[model samples]
Target: MKKLMLALAVASLSSAAIAQETYTVTDVPVKEKSVETNSFWSNWFISAGVNYNAFYSSQEEGISKNPFNDRGKFGFNVAVGKWFTPGLGIRAKFDGVKGVQVNGGVWSPDNIDFDYWNLHSDVLFNLSNMIFGYNENRVWNFIPYLGAGVIRNCSQNNYMMGANVGILNTFRLNKRLSVNFELSALAAPKSFDGIGYKASGNKIWRGADKVFTASVGLTVNLGKTTGFRKAVDVDALMALNASQLDALNSALAAQQNENARLKEELAKKPKEVIKTDYRKEYVGAPRSIFFNIGSSQIASRKEIVNLQVLADAVKADSNIKLKVTGYADSATGSAAFNQKLSEKRANRVADELVKLGVSRDNLVVEGLGGVATLKPNSYNRRVIVDVVK
Candidate 1:
């Protein structure tokens, strides 16, 4: 019955570790670069491993006994674990020992036999960065964890509960798989059942048992998190935006002025009107289009295709510039939802334009939610393309 309960607990833990919630790709771009100093909450993982244990017994008189005549007795353990964050996690383990041998008798010397099983629950702390230099690139690949747990050991005639400490190392193969190795020390409570030996004229039994264990196995992650990349510091990114754009524009203007001056100097020296049939007449206008989607920015295929056509037209016209205005139909939903939906539509159009070879700097994008659009009109669902030359 105890063994059955232990097995159920381990199975439940394993299931929970494997079960994960998935996010949509449209919601978050998967290719976004991760920031170096992001919090650990974003990277969570789960694992399982096969383990081997060494059991050592002791007498009530404070005399410890080595179960092996000349070697330590061996056992087995299996565990399921999950990391709530990058460096912290919890694990549940099922452990058992068989063929345990102990010293017995002084008159007719022979070894006594004992066997037991244990169920444990523990919380793990990561220490890979402390021991080894683990920065962003390497941190995801190699990690070391230390943990402490309560152990419940059950035998044929005895049941003991105690505590244990352990250490483990994991090598991540990818986002969905990893290799794990673990080592632990289990301290079992005192037992008074006598072995087949007499000590100080009293029947001798093993006292507290200390067990050392090691394991290695592979872990499989079930549902994957969409954007596994590092987080971007929004504050830092926003702060850098204006300065970067200004520097870029300044450099571009300087180059354009230099080119114009050189062209004039060359024309003064000697010039010819090199007319070619390949030259195409430019007569395009710059346009800004606005669209109002409802509380959700999940555009249908038809809508996306319409936007694509609009983008292509702008791209074919070198003289035309585009400005996209995104709005929410009403203030019926939560303000936050409306704001996000508006932004989503704006970003979606901007992305499509970029794909159609429109320079992002030349395209202006803005979101005006709820406060502007009073009702849901099919015309309001429309994208207004204002062409400006």
Candidate 2:
């Protein structure tokens, strides 16, 4: 009993360790747009991967002649999940796989090829804390799951209660489709029966069986709704009074007027004019650039300096409208915290640009706290200065 408890404890710890490591191991790609949680039901995922399993029983050991050993195997699963909330979801899956040989013993009159297959159900519990602990919001791209169900050993048609712990790394191939890579370990406390064939007569054996396997597949989601999509709309939400909205509108109008006046003034000033009619005919220089930093909002001094240079460049281009976009790295903090950091970063950069003579209207600032981005790159941390003519 103590050994069984110890094995269970170790398995739980292993599950937690792998769960913590999933986000750290994968590179989160950028999301070009906002994702709506209400639309989660629209997606279906199919995955194939290899897994390593360990069985818990003495009977399983005698039959296979190998216990607690790692076996190479392959498996595939299909799942449909729906997000009832941003961090909570429910998934139903059907998975099947065959075990690989782990022992090096020769197959003679005494030794026989050993393998097992299973079909089971899994309930997914995503570790929201792991997703919120990273510096990049792309942390959501990696989800760790724990599930319990009944396993049927196809070889002998025996049933056993089992549990699985795994990590899934998903790549959004598009809005409704994604590709998944999974690694898992399923544990069953049962032994392989019917090991000795007609030559030696049938006998029951008990032992531990370990299966290690891998697969790749795609998910397609349907029935999507955009209502649950949350974007940075604090200013809009904070406008409690009609007078405040009117004031904001007036301020926006005044800023636009000021921008127009500055453009006219610069056009008349020969010193500020660039003599490039051909350049004017082509696409205008980018007036704004956007960066998606994975879950962190802390701006380094270097980033500040880069913003300063950007502000200076915007000041030099009188016709430019600087749009500063602040992004959080994959979800590492509370939603509220990420949102605040994103807005603060954007506002900080905007305020600095304002000090450099860029009118507020020319700077459209916004924060996308949950926007995902490519991992392992600094390009996600950025400010776009579009020189809009």
Candidate 3:
């Protein structure tokens, strides 16, 4: 029962992870990231779990009897599966069931013990991730499957071909380990149970027999440790690229026009006039370096331009120094949490400035935790840069 509860908790978390897109960088194109190509070993998994199974004979009335009365019928299953894509996969499984207790009602007044070994192949669908969108950090997943296989009934000394449909809930503990809770129903022929349904004392009916099972187990993710490729939002990235290209074109056109205007003005003036030393004043707004929530990486490439500007300013004047302060959103995190997040954000920006030729001694870096906020929670995840002279 404890295993079952743990599985449930993990499954819940996986569902929530699927719905979050926090790492997605808005207003910027996604950088090139590696993805595992489709290959023989790309998306394989292996699992072993303990199962509790109940048998249903056709002779029973009102669907099912007390499942717990025969709850002692425990089983184990081992399976290997692979995903061809994020949505679909196939698995081959072997199950050994024991002491499946059954009561003979009306047809006989005795209890029977059932046991079987089943070898099955199933096609699986990742329903949870499909609807919610795939998240690499997601911890829970829901998979539903349908399968068919041959079952060897050891107690009855017979064999039967059967089909099963079930849902597998996976709670990822980490990249390599996950807990699984699955529930499935198996349908087989009554002959496999050594029970023949009869009409008026003559054997005439052969409807489907039933076996229900619930299992909890751990799965070792094989092949790709992540078991999935990080999904790229192609549409969003393309839109960002188009916007940047358009801005570049507009800037080029404006510069050309400005040069033409300057040439016309110079042509009108005396070319022999004495030239005087002139200094162009550089004026710009302070920059905000944005980061993803819970991330300190220098993610926004656009921010590099801002850092370059500060580097130039500081280089031109040894007296000039820049202050960098980082912050985290308090709406979702604690003070201790925000403090660490803020510190990382500040240091990351400072490191980037240093790499861009600014001296570390000329920069004042501070992690203000959740103190300064420009636009509430989401916008608070940032590092601000101000030049001081």
Top lDDT model:
3
TM-score of 1: 0.48
What is the per-residue lDDT of model 2 for residues 195-310, given as tens digits with 9 covering 90 to 100? 32122224332233334334567766555341134343444445434445575577556655655554555556635533334333222333223344443333454445545555
Worst 10 residues of 2 by lDDT: 192-201
RMSD for all candidates, in order, please.
20.7, 22.8, 16.1
Q: Candidate 3 on 2-113: residue-level lDDT in tens?
A: 4344434444443333323222334433323423347777778899999888777655553336676643378899999987767788999988777443445422436577
- Which 10-residue span in candidate 1 carries the lowest summed lDDT? 20-29
Highest TM-score against the true fold, candidate: 3
In angstroms, give how far residue 389 of model 1 lies from its true place: 25
- Order of all candidates by lDDT, from best down to worst? 3, 1, 2
Per-residue lDDT of 297 in model 2: 38
What tens-digit string does per-residue lDDT give for candidate 1 at 155-213? 34655566767666666676467677777776665441224222343332244556677
Clashes within 3 Å, all models in order: 10, 54, 2
CA displacement after TM-score superposition, residue 290 of candidate 3 (Å): 24
